[model samples]
Target: MANELTISGRIVSVLPLQTGTSKSGHSWQKQEYILDTGGQYPKKVCFSLFGDSITKFPLQVGQDVTVSIDIESREWNNKWYTEVRAWNVTYASQQPQLQAQPPVAQPVPPQPQPAPQPQATGELPF
Candidate 1:
């Protein structure tokens, strides 16, 4: 818990989901996502969700999310590798919902009246 950290950003990409069985014969799954924190100089971070958390957090590109992660480093073959694993993920803020507006009724123009013709005259006047 001491190594836990939180970061918020918009998801730039979603990496392919990885699934395999561990040495203990238990199936595991992991999903990685690239996040971009917009600013004068934006930062990009790659974090992963493991196991059921991957389904619980179901991420998508362009979604703004805040992730709580734990940074871990492990040594393999004399090389140390670091991983940012997200334990919790939530929308940074409530996403705005778009409301459908009712269509406006167009006003109909009034029909023009025809001019009344003068009654027929008996004869032509000088």
Candidate 2:
């Protein structure tokens, strides 16, 4: 909901929580995690959960989960940075999980080709 991007994958890494204070004297905490979408060409995405929600995400490496995140990009000092901010996290659904079936498309069987017959050279040399 609300233009959120949801992705499902197994947790590959969980970085330690980071705590800091804002310039306005407000404390903040953030936790980052990496998820791997296993397939022929596996992809890994790093996302972070901020604020009190960090405690809600008790994810561990090798656990399958679906996460809702917002992609953000900002420019600072003429440099651009991108962030994937996670808002919601839950266990992947039980129905037809990504790991339950093959990721690659099914192989197609080759069709039989006709063999070429020998050419009659010099009447087959009788």
Candidate 3:
């Protein structure tokens, strides 16, 4: 199956680690990033990078990158929170050969319809 979301955007900001303890009694480190996709209104999507993915990408501000993300929604304390988890991310400059998609197939033309026939007018005989 195709990965849920693959978006190309520029990295706007990267947040420092906020230390917290998970329910499993393990320490968790969270880092958030703001990505601008250059839409009608530039979107700033927050992504969480943890462990090795953080070290692998080494996010920096003002870098153009494409992210393979998983979107998730959760309800906490009667409030909903959305998150974009980056499973794969790469610098745009590195993949110049894989830039564009092939053209989409055009739709076929509709067939012509037959003309409507007029009803015969006659004296009523019920």
Candidate 4:
């Protein structure tokens, strides 16, 4: 869409799923997740997936992804509310695997030797 925006980050949390039947007798589902833009000053954004999109993008915590979102606001009961809705989700990149390194041998320190005891004298002196 013309107003769509894209953001890339790691999934910080997955909120509880919400399900209900609409007034027109149709069932709907909504799922929300938090994304953290990692940098010097990280920012957290909460976005939602609706209906089949929830299953289409089975997001998980710690998974890196780029999401296309639409920002919209509505007024209800004289108050305005805004929502960040995600339309597309793609994996950013696979995390790099760390390889194991060979262990280094440590040097052992030498133990100290004990001093010899003095011999006992036989004669008693007064």
List TM-score per model, in order: 0.72, 0.69, 0.66, 0.72
- What is the TM-score of candidate 2? 0.69
- For model 1, which pairs clash? none
RMSD of each candidate relative to the true structure: 8.6, 15.6, 17.1, 12.4
Candidate 2 global lDDT:
0.85
Model 1, position 83: C-alpha lDDT score: 97
The stretch of ten residues in a row with the least summed lDDT in candidate 2 is 93-102
Inter-residue clash pairs, candidate 2: none
What are the per-model numbers of colliding residue pairs?
Answer: 0, 0, 0, 0
Predicted candidate 4 versus true structure: per-residue lDDT over 12-119, tens digit per residue: 899999999999999999999999999999999999999999999988887899999999999999999999999999986684333536788989888888765555
Better of 2 and 4 by lDDT: 4
Estimate, for each residue in 16-116, the C-alpha lDDT of model 2 and write its tens digit.
98999999999999999999988888999999999978877777777888898899899999999999998899886653332565578879999999876
Q: In model 3, state the lDDT of residue 101.
A: 82
Query: Each candidate's lDDT (Cα)?
Result: 0.86, 0.85, 0.80, 0.89
